[model samples]
Every structure is written in C-alpha cells, then in structure tokens.
Target: MAYKKEHVKERFRPKPGKLLDQVREVMHYHHYAIRTEKTYIKWILDYIRFNGTRHPREMGKPEIERFLSHLAVNRKLAPSTQNQALHAIIFLYKYVLDMPLNDYIDATRSKKQKRLPRVLSQSEISEFFKHISGTKELMAKLLYGSGLRLMECIRLRVKDVDFENHQIIARDGKGGKDRATVLPKPIREDLRLHLKGVRKLFEQDLAEGRADVYMPHALAKKYSGAGKSWLWQWVFPAKNYSKDPRTKKIRRHHAHETGLQKAVANAAKKAGINKRVGPHVLRHSFATHMLEAGKDIRRVQELLGHADVRTTMIYTNVMITNFETLGSPLDNLDND
Candidate 1:
C-alpha cells in the first residue's frame, strides 16, 4: 500500500538575540504601532523581572496569575493596566515562544470604576482660549471645534484636512478606524496661514535631504518615496528632527503630545476655571456642547468615533440641567 506524502508546516522562529529582542522581532513582524511596541515591551520586561528572571517558556498559568495578582493587590494597577500586562506576557508565550496557553488564567483583577468625563462650559472654553496662542491655540480650537483627540490632531497629515469639503479625515483613530469630523469655518484662514508656514518648513527639510515623515503600516515600503511628499507631511511637525525609535533614521515626527497637554493645563489655570482641565477636556466639552445645541446623539457618536453609542451616551449625564427651571416644591409652599 502506498501512503500519500504528508506535508508538515514549520513553526515561526525569531532571529537569535536577547529574549526582549525576539519579542520585538515578532511585534514588528505584526506591524504594531510604535507606542504599542514601547508599552508592550515595558510590560513584558516587568513581567519577566517579577518572575525572578525565569524563562516564560519554563512557567505557565499559575506564574502568570501570581504576577497579575501582585499588580492588583500591591501595585494597585487599574483594570485596564493589569490587562495590558497580561496581554504582553500572553504575546511573548503564544507568538514568540510558539507555546499557546490553552488553560484559563484566573488572575486577581482590579475593579473598574465609573467616572464622568469633565466638561467645560462655553464661557470657560472662551476664557481658556484667550490664554493660549499660536500653534497650540489652533490645535486647541480643532479639539473643541472638530472634536478630535489630541493625538488625532497631532498626527494629521496635510492631505487629511479637507477645507473644500469642510471636514477633517481622522485616519487610524482608536480601534484603527477612520472617520470624518467637522472643520470649524472660523479657523479656516488661520489654518491656511498655518499650512503656509508648514509648507515652508517642508521645503527646508527637502533642501537639507531629510524630508521623510513616518508612514503607517507598509506604505513606506510600498510607496518608497512617498514619505518625502508634501501631501504626506505632518500638519503639526516637530520643530527638530529626531531619530525614529524603531528604524534609527533621522526624521521629523509629529509635535509631542506633552507640549500641548502642558499648554492646555496652563491655559486652564490662567483662565481660573476650578475643575481639572487638559487637552481631552476640550474634546469632552465639544461633545457636550454639540449635544446642548440639539445635535443628534447618533451623529455626535459618529463624529467622536465611539464604537458604541453607550460610550457616547455618557455625555448626556453631564449635560446642563437648570435646577431653577424645574422650581423646588418648597417655593410652591406659601410662607405663612
């Protein structure tokens, strides 16, 4: 009897290096975001150190549970943070080591808390803007007007802003989804002048032979020279060239989020609003204000790029409630 030839597939093996390096190799192969790559690396390193430098392949579910329990009980890590650490370790074992964890991991979990997002009143927003000027001011306006997250506004490419259609295409937003949002008409001319300056900066970079901007996914490899194109240039490019953390190539990146964050905080303090404020408060204010204007909740959900309407519904809880209009029953009781 003749037996048919059986074909066996070989498992993936990373290039020989340090353990962390092999983890990075797998992450890079999967095209993880730079921020995600850094975060996962940090978590993975923390997990290994917590295990007393034991190889992950040598340990399994119980060790994983113990490490996570420590994070919850001792470190007091939030549910999201503990979960992130768990995911990083799972990636190390499943992807890099080719050892899939088949058993359930019943780790001690941090309890999730419900908190309402802080929102600014219209007058407070106006007062806040009075303190911030120049590039940061434009960014702040976009956050309130276009309902963009801080990084979405920062990572915006030149082509993403469509003045003709009065929309800004927010690409690769949370969950890697794209959505269009309103571009405030009041700032169009200011944005135009801003782009003129950005264009001049782009020209200068090209003249110096360092015009490349970071491209997402395989676009850099597929397009090859597209990174140097003006259309692909960052709307808010960093003032100085910095080495790419992954590639080590000198290139200009988007403006750091911390600068804008600090600017917003300072502006809030200067405006003398009592509640805590940051760049995201502007976004929250935008959502609440839009709803206050009687804009449809579903439409607001689309603009905010929330995957669930329930996430968008949180804004309704904080919407302005005029207690005086309701009239207290005590007022109805005549004073004898």
Candidate 2:
C-alpha cells in the first residue's frame, strides 16, 4: 500500500511555535552570518506582530507592500533600513513560508539623500585623543589608523593582528569579505602592552575553567579546543561573561560596541572640536587622510575594503586639493 501524499506533507511540516527555529536552521544550513540571522529574524517577528500575529502563510505580496509602505510613511525608516526589511520579508516568503513574492513590490520607498562623509583634520584628531584614555583610546587609534569600521575593530582576535608586518588582517569585514589594512607604527607599543594585560585576564579565566570565547562557523566543534585557546580569544574581551543563546555556554564576548561609541562621543564633546564625531568619523578621517597624503586611490580602496572604487571616490570631493587645484577663469583672464 502507498502512503498518502497529504500524510507525507503533514509529517514533514514544522510543529507549532517551531517556525522561527526552522528559519534559523535553514539560515544556518546555508551559512548565513550570525548578524544576518538576527536581523532577518527580528524583521520577520516585527512583520508578524504588525499584522496582529497573522501567520505569514496567510500573507502575500499585497500585505508585504503595505508593511513596507508603513515602515517608510509611518516609522520613517531609512531607505536602506526599509530595503533590508523588505528583503527579510521576501526571504521569509521564498524560503520559510514557501510562497513566492512578485517580481515587483509596489510600496512607498523611503527617500534616501546623498551626503558626504565628515572627516577630521589632523589637529582635531590630536585633540579628540586627549579626552579618551586606556582601552577606548587604543580602540580609537585602531579605527583611525587601520580604517576599520567600528565592528571590525572590536571583533578582532589575537591571530588577526600582525605586528611584524605592520598590518591588520580584518576578517569577515563588510559584505562578508576580508582585507588587510596598515597598523600605524605609533600604536604598536601601546597595543603590545595592552595585549600583555589581556593575556593576564585570559590566564585568570582559564584558571576559573571559563576560558572559552565565542567562535563562529562551528569552529569550536571542529577544533574542539580552539575556543579556549589564547589565539582565538577576543583581543578586546568584555569585562563580564554572558550566556551564549545557542549553547548556553558562558563565554566572554567582545566589548559591547555601544560602550566604545559612547566613550568616543564623550571624548569628542570634551575636546570641543565637534563636527558630529563618532567612531565611524575616525574611519572616514583615515580614508580622507590617506588620500590627502598622496596614497593611491586604488590602494585606499583595498585598505578600506570598498567593493567599488566609486565608494572610495567620495573622499576626493572632501579633499583639500580639489579646492587647491581649482583656478578661476577670472584669474586666467590676466594673461589676456
């Protein structure tokens, strides 16, 4: 006797309240980054909650369009943010719910404007450093020196730093790509001394049988012992241990990004040379300064891990040489 098709389908379907878990399992199977998994899940949950907890199985393209329009017209989300939410919903329909979205989604798209990045002068950078001290100060130097995004600087591990070569191997940067950037000579000794303190902390953690730090890509399972090793430890470990959601393993993760951001903001305010400075401003300053110092634009693109040269070209607009090189037609008329 043959089994019924409906019975087979029912056996395979997820049980109630397990839909999100299924989404996570699919995301993990495809090797989506942890951040992406979190973001997608958040948007999906918000979408469900916004529609009075209606199952996505009952929703279609029309519902998705209205939700996206609400985000733009009501929440005033950035275009990028609105687009991200749309992608998350699309993924849910296509993958999780097994429903296909239309080729075109009609919605009120958030209007995004082009804005030039803010850069700090060399003197302003010097003043900004005066207010921050210790680890926060070192982190700022790394951001400006290496042109690292805030997450890239904080996510660094011991193995990623190359002192002898004067470079930093930034792993899993934006768009899930890696690139190398120069590690300024001025911060080398300070970084070395800071590592000495981190090493002591790691030793203490090991003594307490809690040396394990968070590892990605199932690396902890593959190596079995790498998570507890000094080489894989966070270069900037958090002061306290937290429970990992998946494994419930108590581990010391990286320093929270917000803490460093707030520290930088306070430092900028204390220095009183404000042009809306933040950790990212330091990165912008790095790219702009490299261009000003005659570094090749292509080389800057590589160091900054920009996928397109056009993104790096934005710095050229803010460079002082653009004005310095300009000569008015009135000035040239003197020759006539």
Candidate 3:
C-alpha cells in the first residue's frame, strides 16, 4: 500500500499529516533537510504532549525554554543533547511556527560548554580492537585511522577511498563540509580485500539485472546511469535495499551506527575497560594520540577538521592530564 505521508495506513485512523501540515510546510520553505524536518516535528510533538497535550500554539517561549532546561537541568542531558533539543525548538519558532524565538528567551539559558573528548591509550585501543571483528572492526579503524565521525565512517562510499592518493575523502561531514584524511598504513591491505568483496557483490547485482545504485540526492536525476557506477556504491552498504520515500526507489544505505555501537560495547566488556567506549571515542583517541606524539596543534586542528582553534586546544588538555605542569597562578601565594 502506498502511503502518502508518515502516518498510519488504516482508513479510519485520524491521520497525523493534517495536524502537522502547517509545521511541515514552513520547514520545507526554509529548505531544511527531510531528516531534520522529521526530527524537529517529532520533538515538537513530544514537547506538546509533555505539556499535558496543550497545543504548542497555546504555549509561550518560556514554556519551551523550561522544557529544554528540564532536559539539561533535571534530566542531566549532555551538552550535545541540550543543543539538539534547542536546535529543534529554534527551528520550530523561526521556521515552522513563523515567530522569533529570541523575542522571549534570554541569552543566559543555553547549553553549557563542551568538555574535552575522552580518549583511549594506544594499548587500550589495541586491546579494544582485539575483541571486535568484521564490520565493527572496519568501522573502528575508520574512526581511529581516518579521524572520521561515527556517521562519516558509516556513510563512506567506494569512491571516497582514494587508494592511489592514500587518503579517505569524507563527504557531508559536520557543517556540510567535505575533507580528506590519511589512510592508515595498517588498513591498506584490509581495505583492498574489502574492495574485492564489494566488486564481486557489484558484479552479481549487475548480473541479476539491478539497473542502478543509489546516488546522493538529486545526482541520480541529473545522471540516470550514475547509480550503477562504481563511484556511487557505498563502501559499507546495508545488506538490503530500502524504499526511498521521495522517489519511491529501492536503495542500499550504509550500515546503521547502532550496530557499531553495540559492537563497541561488547568489545569494551570483553576487554574489561570501564570507560564508556563509542565510535567518537576512537576519533578522540586519534586526536589526543597525535597531540601527545608532539605533532603541531595547527595540523591536528586541520586533520580533525575542527573549524575553531579553540576546539582543537581542548585536545591538548586531553593529552596532558597533569595540571600541575602548567605552573598555576596560585604559586604566587608561596612567594608571598
């Protein structure tokens, strides 16, 4: 059955689209990505329901602020969590609700500063890797070896790996920026083996009369045959094709990050390491280890694709945990 929107298929159901159409229309006008639109709508609905099903239209900015504050202050969400909620509400006001969020909310009530990222020791990393295998092992290698974010590792395409140049080209990183990272010396062989398997899969798909692959966004429309091209195939494709809503086409996406997350957890337990290990931990370990090796901070900043030097500066602290080495201003008290 073809469903027109993201709602129940039953004919007698009250249908959700009518309730959220105005909100969706405004977000569409602002050119927000469909994933973001869905997220913001879901958050908005949660906000409304949490406020005793009071219509969001009836609530003021103070109420919205309180809800976000509750997430941070009471629920003790991380800074990223607070920011995600904030971005959703901000989008709802400026785009969906067609109002100014700044008009009612004070500047003093936003998310807190981000602390330095948690990193693992080289030995710890090796032990962690010993416990994982197959897809999870490859995913972790991308995170640590290429300095990729969790999503970036999963979203990689076959063409993104420039073996000739020994670099991994990351497309659609944070802030929609694309950059390249060094391909680790160790994984060159592994990637080559992985590519051969992918080639066999691609050939089989072609033999089975699969006309094309899924290209990113409107690229498929512009070049109808581009999907079948080797460049368009994901480096880590899902086992099956998903039905794309907008075009109603079946396409293979990359593996879900949650699978890698679960893998990391099991590996962490097997290794008997207590610190919470996630894919981002590998990225942090990459940055911190580079800094600890006496690499130039500016270069580390570039390699990590950090926009601000201040963001990169945080990693230096991650490497040098002993604050006593800084020779604190309190030393003047001893002289006095």
Point out the worst 10-residue segment of candidate 2 by lDDT.
1-10
**94-175: candidate 2 lDDT, tens digit per residue:** 6666675755788888888789999988888999999999999999999999999999999999999999899999998887
Residue-level error in angstroms, candidate 2, position 97: 2.1
RMSD (Cα, Å) for all candidates, in order, is 5.9, 6.4, 7.5
Q: Candidates 1 and 3: which is better by lDDT?
A: 1
* Per-residue lDDT value at 4 in model 1: 19
Model 3 bad stretches (over 4 Å): 1-35, 100-104, 107-116, 209-211, 245-248, 320-336
Candidate 2 lDDT score at position 108: 88
**Which pairs clash inside model 3?**
none
Evaluate all candidate structures by whole-model CA lDDT and list the values in order: 0.90, 0.86, 0.75
Per-residue lDDT tens digits of candidate 1, residues 126-185? 899999999999999999999999999999999999999999999999878999999999
lDDT at 297, model 1? 99
The numbered model that scores best in TM-score is 1
TM-score versus the correct structure, for each prediction: 0.94, 0.88, 0.81
Query: Which wins on lDDT, candidate 2 or candidate 3?
Result: 2
